[model samples]
Every structure is written in C-alpha cells, then in structure tokens.
Target: MSKPITKTNNWVLGLTGGIGCGKTAVSNMLEELDVTVVDADIIARQVVAPNSDGLNAIIEYFGQNILLPDGTLNRAELRSKIFTNNENKEWLNALLHPLIRLKILTDLNNATSAYVVLVAPLLFENNLDKYCNRTLLIDVPIATQIERTAKRDNTSIEQVKSIIAAQMPRNEKQQKADDILNNDRNLSLVHTELVVLHKNYLQYALQNTTNAP
Candidate 1:
C-alpha cells in the first residue's frame, strides 16, 4: 500500500526483503544508477558510535560487555545476546528505535538524488512504510535464502532458518509490496527488472516534485 507524503521532494522508496535476499546487491545497483540510499543497517551502526548519546544509553543498559576494545559496539555479541534473550532484545529496541527513526528522517530530508531508497531489513515489520511513498519488495524463495545466507555468513542452515522465521514471512511481504522485484534468478534478470523500476521511480519523482508556493 502507498502512503501520502506531504513533501514531494522527499519521495521515498522503502526497499526490503528477507535475509539473504540480495538486498545489498539491489541497493548497490540502485546506487550505481545514482539513486541515493538511506539504509537502516548503516544508520543502526551510526547511532551507536563511540561517543553518541545512543551509545551511552546502550552502555548504561547493556553495560560494557556491549562494547569492543576500540570502543565500537560489539555487534556480534549484541546479536547473540538479543537473539537468545527476548527481554534483552526488546529493551534494546526500546532504546534504539526512536533514535534510528530520527536519523532516518534527517537523512531522507537531506537526500539529493532523483528519489531515495530507504533500504531496511525490517521495513514492513517496523511499519516504516508510513515514511515511504511506495514499498518495493524483493522476492526470493526460502530455500534459496537459507542456502545463500548460510554460505555467505559461514553459518549453518538452521541458523539462517531461525533468522528467517523471526522476520515477516515472504508471502506477507509480497502481498504488501506496491511493486515487486522478482529476484529468484540471475543478476541479469534482477538488473532488467531494476532498470524498469528505475524509470518508474524517476517519472514518479518528476511528476510529484512540486514547485514552492
């Protein structure tokens, strides 16, 4: 479903998919085509940088174990902790999500490309489609997701399945997408579909960009 954005210049494309669905590859391709991408994963890291308020909040709650020798957040340790302990995960989300949302809005407002792609793994789950003009879902089979993620992350298929099960299911995502990128095949096919979406986004942006009153 499409949401009404009051600003025309900030036309946002909320791009999302399941784990190991090649969202990184698709975002890179869109970037190569000159689309500005405000990625949630990248923002998530930035919010907890060494001296930030978000980091301080995290340390106060999770303690020093969440940090590395170099003062960066210990992402692996946090991932393990949160995945294993539901309470820890919920507490962390309570602390970080508001900060992340504020940063995302600032980034989107500052974007200079024809249109922006806000790449997020949990776009739908977080109800972030509210910030977007359209939602783009990249579709891939679960077996493929398990295979690719396990291979790329050097983890087991079971671990990948656990991660996938924790997310919004593939069918639910497909149903919510305003536009779908069928990415079950090779890069060439993905690129072909992306090019078409690129054109569509450009036209949408141009049509929606309003002159100042």
Candidate 2:
C-alpha cells in the first residue's frame, strides 16, 4: 500500500509542466538554489536500465527490435514507435507507471534534505500530486512550447504538438499549482521567482509537523 501524505519536517515539492514547458530549466535553477531535486524522468530511465525487471518487461512486450545488440533498450527506436502509434503509447504507459511510482515513493521516503523536489512532466495526470506539500508548474505559451521543443529536439511542430496532446493541458496544470513560474520571457525573472519559492518553502517546511494539514 502507498504511504499516506502528511505534513513533515521534510518539504516535498512537485514540479510539473506540459511538454516543452521548460520544466528542466526551472528544475536546474531549483537545484542551484540548493533544493534536493528528484527527477521522475531520470528515475524512469534508471528503473528500466539493462538487466532490470522494468527493462525486461518492456522487452517482453515489444521484443528484441526495441533493444540494442549490446542488450540496452533502443530508446530512440522505442520513442519513434510509441510516439507515432496510439496503441503502442498506452501499452508503454501501462508497462511503466506502476514500477515508476513504486521507485519514486521509495526514494522520496528516504530523502533527508530540507525539501525534495519531484520533477514530473505528468505530475497531475499520474495522480502523484497528492503526495506533494506544494505543487509548482513551469508554464509557457503553446506557441512557445511548440517552437522551443522543435528547436531543441530537432523535431517538427506537429510532432511536438502530438506530445503536447498526450499531456494534461497548461490551464489544468496552472489551476493545480501552488506556485507558477512563467519562463517564456526573461530568464532572470524565473530565477527571482525561485528565490521567493525557496524562502517560502523553507518557512513552510519548518512549521510542518506530522499533524499539519
């Protein structure tokens, strides 16, 4: 069973955004500010590493074509397959989410920092936000999201939009955030916002106890 969410001396922050919303950039800024940031994407990759059960399960589902001759999953080929095909997409999520959740919770329970930031692209969609004391959303305009991702990933606009469509919308994310950082403009502004968030979260962490609501 999952552990219950309670206010603790350790502050748990959920950082999330839609595709191409610059969540990684915002997370890097938080890390610079001394926050203990745990990225779900990073852990996802780790859980599925060669010889791991997660990778084994994925291979069983999709077969050897999804793997390298060296035995590692061919991530690029897998991405191409799932992102282009709707059925394969759901199949992938069904294979991955439970194991990812278990890994995240185990890591989070062991965290000793003043606060731990869980950076998840689908924080709300996956219902992981319930564990966070506060949720932060990194936001950008749809046009900005498409353009930035296309330039960075070297993919077409339609491809970027396809990824975006698979995620929860920006407005829904905004409504759920306790804090929102808009990164479409000046980078400095985002840093300033993080400063405020760091201070506020520190204070919140101090006051939080097992009984805190």
Candidate 3:
C-alpha cells in the first residue's frame, strides 16, 4: 500500500551491503512495498550492452577477445580479466562508473515515489552514497559473506576472499549506514524488521515534508 500523502517530495535512498549480503533481496522487498527502485548493476549492464559506446570503450581498452562471436560482451571473459588484473579492474571501473552514474541520475530524477531505493554494491567505494539522502545497509557477518559467496557463486574460497577484499570492510559499511537491515536470519524475521522500518520511514517522510518549504 502507498504511504499516506504528505508534503515530502521524494527521497533517494542508497541501499548497499558487502558481497553476499542480500542487497538484491532487500531491493526487491522495497519494490514490493511500492517504493521505486533503481538498480546500479542493471544500469551498468545496459550501458555496456553490445554496440553501445561503453562496449566500444571496453573493447579499445581490453581488446576484442572479450566479445563473443555474436559481438556481445562475454561477461565471463570480462570478469576474468578484471578479477585477475588489478589495472584492468581499475580501467573497467573508470570507464563504467561515470556512465552508470549518469543513467542512475536520470532514473532517479524521474522517480515518482515518496522515496526511491538505489541498490549499489559499491555505493561507498564509488562514493555514490553522497547522492542519497539516506543509506540502507544489509548487514551480514564476514564469515557468512565468505561462505554464502563461495556456495552461491560456486567459486573457491580464495576467489571469494579476493572479491570480498575488493569491497569496503563490513564494519566500515555498517558505520556509514543511516539505517541497517540485518539479513543474517530467515526471511520471516527480515520481513518483520522491514515492516517496522517502513512505518518509521513513512513517519520520517511525513515530518520532512511538513517542515519543507
């Protein structure tokens, strides 16, 4: 159900978490609550779609071998390149971050909800958190992150550790959050927490709007 109408125009909420922290699930839950959701990863993929300028830049930086026979980016190949090479990883981020940010801004500008949820795995790393009025972090333990990632991605522990290392520390992320969603337990508990948070957010929105010019 939609929140009661108030003077608050809109809010941009950045949703983030460490690897395997269920950020996607939280985004989905927000969408089910009728909150607009803008996903950075989806926008990143769009900007890199075949024949796009992003694809061209990537090819120039890494060569055509990263593309499949049909000329689409072979994500597995690109993942391997960036994951295995630190410089390549930096180059990819440099090329994609600006483009992704632009698209995210465009999407946020058109959002019609009381607030919008922007899901970014590296919200802090990329400094995109600055664009948000509030930040929501999905908190999960480091050990759980490693175990979940290893099992979910079907990758070795070392590989999972590498990905985790590439992200901000869990404690640092938690400290940066305006609101924290603990996702270490089952869905039932998570849903109850979300319900309470949603009500609080609605009240907050109402107050903010009432005080706005």
How do all the candidates rank in terms of lDDT, highest first?
1, 3, 2
Q: State the lDDT of candidate 3 residue by residue for 1-213, as single tens digits.
A: 964322223667889998898988888888899989999989988999988999999999889998999999999999999877999999888888778887888788778877777899999998888788788899999899999999998999999998899899888988889999999999889988988887777777677678878
Model 3 spans > 4 angstroms off: 1-9, 60-63, 79-91, 208-213
Clashes of 3: 0
lDDT of 2 by residue, 128-213 (tens): 89878899998999999999999999999999999998888788888889888888989998888789988998888777754467
Error of 1 at 203 (Å): 1.0
User: Evaluated with lDDT, which candidate comes out highest?
Assistant: 1
TM-score of each model, paired residue for residue? 0.90, 0.86, 0.86
Candidate 1 lDDT, tens digit per residue, 8-37? 358899999999999999999999999999
lDDT for model 1, on a 0 to 1 scale? 0.90
What is residue 93's positional error in candidate 3, in angstroms? 3.3
Q: Candidate 2 deviates by what RMSD?
A: 3.2
